[model samples]
Target: MLDDEARRALSRWTVGEPNAIREYAHGAINQTWLIETARGSYAFRRCAQGGAEVVRQNHRLIGEAVARGVPTVAPVVVEDGNTVVVESGRVYALFPFAAGVQVDRDRLSNNDIQAMGRSLADVLEALRGCDRSLVKEGRYEVCVSEAIREIDRLLSVISELPPGEPSDENALERLTTRRAWLVEHGVEDGDPFADFDRQPIHGEFQDRNLFLGDGKVSCIIDWDNASWSPPEWEVAPFLDFVAAYDKVKVAAFLAGYRARCKLPDERLDACVWAYGLYRAHDLWLFREVYDRRNDKARRFLTPGRFKPHFERWLRR
Candidate 1:
């Protein structure tokens, strides 16, 4: 529930009389609310993670993409001609609610998968034309030493935990196994694809951010992670989605993407490798569970959550 002060602040926008405002629980980082008004329902979001500058940049890029025929919802301009309203150090913005369903990976048909791929390609192609000055350069470098040290630190923490749940035990096993894999594979530092050009991409392109309707992507939301990076970084999530390395589905997705833009097989392979290395070094889930004491992340602690994906990427 929003306090009267916050609600009054949001009223400055031209959205209309607010009939209802309810907290939206789906978002992990930003605080969101479904605001119902006489005109229409809107998604009111408080920029939680990034500051006002990021919110403004995202709005600019989203506006650019929408203008270029990308399927996405844009922020509504406020009374001050700005898309976002800064109230007491908090930034808030409203977007017309995008109505669609979020489909799981297994439930997606080949056509749906292909459409998903095509839609992503369309978004990338559209944003690629934007002046690079509008966005910040994205990071492509990988540091194995830091990851190794973090793994060791996590292992040390796990060692102190009193023997209890299977989750703790699983964490121990995963940490040790990942450390060994890092050494055996000789995971090195620095960006392998430094020679490639970087462009603006949807940083967190995944199932949750994508919405489906009528067997096609209705809207691609959450431009918060948008940045300038190698185009292949966006494609890595699809590799993880097509579990067990299902070549047919992979081929369908790639074909769909290729239909809209040029993604050579060699470049795609390199991107997947880069994504795999990222997964191997990623400790956010562990950090959330142990460091932040976030229990919600425990469900993803299953044994096959990461190893299978990493192994598949290796084979590719």
Candidate 2:
């Protein structure tokens, strides 16, 4: 997928000419490639948005994290002595190739799940004393109001689906059932945001972003979503995701997490409430928000892809 112009632009950051480039298959936000050169191999990332400044901030954050003993990938400074390089109207960054395997929640063993929790704690601890002001304010998570709007919009779309078709009929029934369940029980009893501890947390610490080497966490990648927020704001969704996949491993993860920080049951319950509402909102919007404009949205909207997850979340 590398055109001559793109290859030339990327060569600027390499030790020598780029001998080969292979695109990594599983990402939506950015295009990643394994770049090989006479000198060595590097991970090349082309960010589609946020420009150079965002990339620079990510570089700085990762650097700070690395210095604090957190396993992470910091960008390798290019020839210009900057972590980010502008090339052909796009922003690119080069990183040293970190060998590891990215395990999904379904495939995670008891030990792997526990390690994930500890690694997540490590990330939180490493970021504890840093200048919180340096991190961005707004989170990438869907806003409460936005989630409501998306749910309503998705319901409308479902209603418009042609009747009598087996697949559409089944989808309609499922959406209606989920919408009713969420409307009835998804709202939290009280606002957890009234007064809560806010700090810089890994905004998106999902399974795919975590890398494992041997038996321990080799590194955590994709710092693009780093932001300052209530710890519950991030942890709540994470717990739900982990629970959805494998509830048996939840205790191991919690044990690992508690080894570093205290997560009281009351506080975690409140976080779960908040996360439930957020997930309910994302259920409909995940597919409807972008329609066909975004490929991820389309894939999510396709029957059996995301609806099942939403259904499971609602059932809980």
Candidate 3:
């Protein structure tokens, strides 16, 4: 349900009363709302603080993708011809609602994985030259150094924490353990593919972000972290995500991906190891920071969850 201020803020974007302002409580960062009006239903999202520029760039990029016949839930232009609307110092964007269901791991078959792969390849191709202004931090370039410094900072905080706060101490210990694991695995080593082919990738191209309708991908949503990256950087993560459930399904996905786009064999091998380390580092960061702040963050922190996943993939 929406409060009075939220109702007023949303009314500016729609022609009629903003009825059915139901919250879509899936994402961790943004506040999403499903709104219905006399005109049409829309997915309205209040972006996180300091995300206005990212939203603007996404609006531009998604619009370009739609022009190229890609299936994307692009943001709608308000009365002022702006995709983003700032009201009460908060930035919001209204997207034309895509009627589809998000596929879960249990429901994902080889064919579904193939469809996902094909659609993602099409999206990556369509996103070329959309925007060159905002560059997302590449995993190999920043993730390790940043995660290392953050772990040290968190350990300091844990030391200062009042004694007998066993839960806090445990969480911080987990963080340190992950940091050591990453360092032992040579995460801070120099990048092998420093000059790899780079382009804009759907930063969070995973199952939850894809919308399926009529046995096909209807739309790709949430372009918050769209930025320049290597094909392997994005492809490896998507493969890792699907492979977590079943390896056979991942092979089908790779077949579909290769049919549409050429993923260099060497790049894929190196990037998988790089991304595995990055995921290991990132999951621990999520655990340390959000342990007390939000319980949902625990889902990413299941006691060295990505350890074996990284170890196996990196060694291969």
Among all candidates shown, the one with the greatest TM-score: 1
1-316: candidate 3 lDDT, tens digit per residue: 8766566667777557876678986776678998888888888888873566767877787777778888887787778788887778788888888868887876887877888888888887877766666456554544566677877877776677578754565666677777877677644455444767778777888887888888778888887777787766667777766666245776878888888998776766767766665566564445434444655444444443225354666443
Whole-model alpha-carbon lDDT for candidate 1 = 0.79
lDDT of 1 by residue, 1-316 (tens): 8876568668878777888888976665677888899999988888875778888988898888888888889998987788888888888888998868788778877887788888888888788878886677776567888888999999898789899878988888888888887777745688755766788887777777788998788988998878788878788876685433687777778778889888887877777777777677778888988998877667667763236354686564
Worst 10 residues of 3 by lDDT: 297-306
- TM-score of every prediction relative to native: 0.86, 0.81, 0.85
Candidate 2 structure quality by residue, lDDT tens digits, 1-316: 7876567767677578777889987776688988888988888888865888877877788888888888887788876689887777788888888768888777888888778878777788778877776578743243444544665776687577666645544445556665665555555434435456677777888777888887778888888877777766666656666655345666778887888788998876666655554555555334633354345333333354223343443355
Q: What ranges in model 3 sit over 4 Å off? A: 134-139, 142-149, 156-173, 187-193, 280-288, 291-296, 305-310, 314-316
Off by over 4 Å in 1: 3-9, 20-22, 158-170, 242-244, 292-298, 305-310, 314-316
Pairing residues by index, what is the TM-score of model 1?
0.86
Local accuracy by lDDT, each model: 0.79, 0.69, 0.71
- Superposing every Cα of model 2 onto the true structure, what RMSD results? 4.1
Which residue pairs show backbone clashes in model 3?
none
301 in model 2: Cα distance from truth in Å?
4.1
Maximum-lDDT candidate:
1
